[model samples]
Target: KEGRKLEQTARLIQKTAEAKNMPATKRAALNMQKLGRRMAQGRMDKKQAMVRMAQLTKQMQAQQRQLAQQAGQAALGGGKSLSQAGQQLAAALQSQAAGGQNAQGASKMQGAHSAGSKSTGEKSGANGGNKPAGQNAGHGFNVPGRNKPGDKPPQNALHGAAQPTPEMKQIAQALQQNNAQTLSEQLRQLARKAETGQMTPQQQQQAAQDLQKLADALQGTGMPETQQHAQAAAQAMAHGDKQTAAAEMRKAADAAEREAQQQQDAQGMQDAQNSLQDSQGEMAGAQDPGDIPDGPSGQGQGQKPGGKGQGQTGPPEYGGEGNGGRGGGRGKPNTTYHKGQKPSHKIRQKPGYGADAPHWLDPHFDPAKNPRYAKLYFGKPRTAGPSQAGPTRKTRPGEDTGPVRSTVPYYNSVVSARKTAENAMDREDIPPAYKKNVADYFNSLQPQSPPPPASSGAGGTKP
Candidate 1:
């Protein structure tokens, strides 16, 4: 029983190495390698090895299903094929297996295995031989054109595989049927799934790309509503607002349905035209009358029937018979004041005629044109008084006045001299004499009157 179990494990490993499902085959190959190590190291007995092998078999089976599903998804998503993925996985597994043994021996074995596998794959492709063990090459399912069990994956096939989603399947079906309404509905559901964060980012991106393709197809078929929904879905995915995109898709579906119904009903078409005409008439009527220009005779074109100046009687022109004078229908003159009433005689000069007029007020006044007045008017104006009046006498600091009089000039002069002396003293280079002069000047500026004597008492005056 132990020998039989060992043989079975070897067979399973060989079959896994040849499997067409790349992910599953790789997983199985890895487990087989680990099992071989355990057996060689004497770590697992017969019963234990059998149990582990059974576990591995079950795991491989599940993985196979997963890998198949992934391949289908890849085809639907417009990516790599199942056979290409499997070939890549086989190569990786062989490399791993080779690394486990003695270097020289492993290299020899790996070369043999690669050559044999290549020949076998070629034979199957050219002669239509029986499908290899543990491979799904000859299955009846529809696959991408380039996909075949023995075919190698593209150089850029290193990216992880994407699993199929319900939304993706529905979209594929809708596309196959070429039904715009159905496609719109499926896209809406996909957008909703993306909005709820149920789908992975990669899946969302793929869905968005597919939607764009569908939109293009629909656009070519004269289904703008459906195309719009798909475009909106793509945009929503880009902005991460899947819910809004879904809503837009739903609206597109509804619009398509409505359009179909409208095509089938002739009365609906007539009603729509009538409604459009009514709306246009209302818009024209709502326009402001003042916006329209009056004709030469002061009558506006396109005016309503009952508007002013239509048929109502009014005063005739100057030559009509109603009035005696040339003026039509004589009435009180339209004047604020009587003919003899004159305004005030206060003559006012024009704006630019004043002496204080700004230079810019005279358009012809350019400094370059007339340089004579440039210094007088364009440059700073002359001071109001003479530039240099009589020389101001400089009095000596701290000089005493003859008397103290309660007059403005006397007080002003004294205050001014004191301030001048104080300012001179503040200068760093001034001598101490200047400070002394300021102090003396301040004392002289004080009033000369003595203080009044205090009263003897409140009730007994001089007594």
Candidate 2:
């Protein structure tokens, strides 16, 4: 009966020791405590109790070894499994503590626990050290374990000392081609890679240079807002501010798109204007001069047939009879006069000369009839009339105060040129200093009001 009872107690202790919820070491400790109680109660002999305690201790040690093996496997996998491995190691140590029976056993358990802890620490360090600098810093905490004693610290990719990469060269070429959209996209990608610690130091530096080049190209495009954004993005990249750089790159792309649209619109307008001008010129050239109406002077109208002097076909001679007369008549009639015969009508002197003219003004000395007179008075005199009281100022032909004709098309052309220049000056991409000069040039071209016609004084005298 005692043997059967002892067997039942040993089986119960084993079952309790292996409970999943309770740690193996705790179970072993409980088992030892229970065995001591059984011995004190005289329910078991010391030899049998010792034997059962030894078996429990071996079982706990075996469970601990299994946990250590699992930890080693987790560590080798290089994942969150590593943390799991650490938890398992802790569990194994506790299990060892529970199974310890004597001082020697306690010492062995401590040594095993230390070994398990050391292995977990080394696995964690290895995992941290292998990660990229960007990834390591991304979590907001700098783990000192990332830097092993024999490992060199990772360098920043965007440091000034890094050299350009082949990708950077390609990006620069794209910039030179004025491919703002493409360059902006490329820059964004590079910045993202940089943020994720995927770029090498050289590649990061190259990306920064490429961004600067793109900014310069945008500046050339003459879009101020876009250029400003591009420059900001470049500066951000240089400072390793990938987030800012990415945002600025997007802005630059938008600005570039707007500028391109504006250019297209301007080009379309220019083409339409050119086409209209060309069509108008063609229409004007197609018209015949013979189709025009005769002037109010009856000049260029066909002569009347069968009229008194209609058949005269010879070219008219200069200074001929009635050739240069001001009266609106075709030709003067020829008349034969006898000597001493009274003229039918009194002969009037030429319009400009006076009857009391000097002796040099012979009766036949008509300015229209004489080449010398015509040469002497090459142009009409400004002082020809008596009421012309101003000094005889020599004037060029066509200087008379005739009605001025307005050249609307010519004015429009000038205005268009000035407007184009002004628009260029208003562009953000243009240098501020150069913009002032551009504005000045266009302003100078604009027609200014004639200086308020110099205000007249009260007495009508010039101020």
Tens-digit lDDT track of model 1 for 203-258: 56555655554454444333445557767866776576767766766776675454
Question: How many residue pairs in model 1 have overlapping backbones?
Answer: 0
Clashes per model (N, Cα, C within 3 A): 0, 3
lDDT of all the models against the reference?
Answer: 0.40, 0.42
RMSD of every prediction: 38.2, 45.1
Q: For every model shown, what is its TM-score relative to the native structure? A: 0.23, 0.29
Give the candidate number with the greatest lDDT: 2
Judge candidate 1 against the unseen true structure and give its global Cα lDDT, from 0 to 1: 0.40
Those runs of model 1 whose alpha carbons end farther than 4 Å from true positions after fitting are: 1-169, 175-181, 262-463
Ten contiguous residues with the weakest lDDT in model 1: 316-325
What is the Å distance of residue 128 in model 2 from its true position? 22
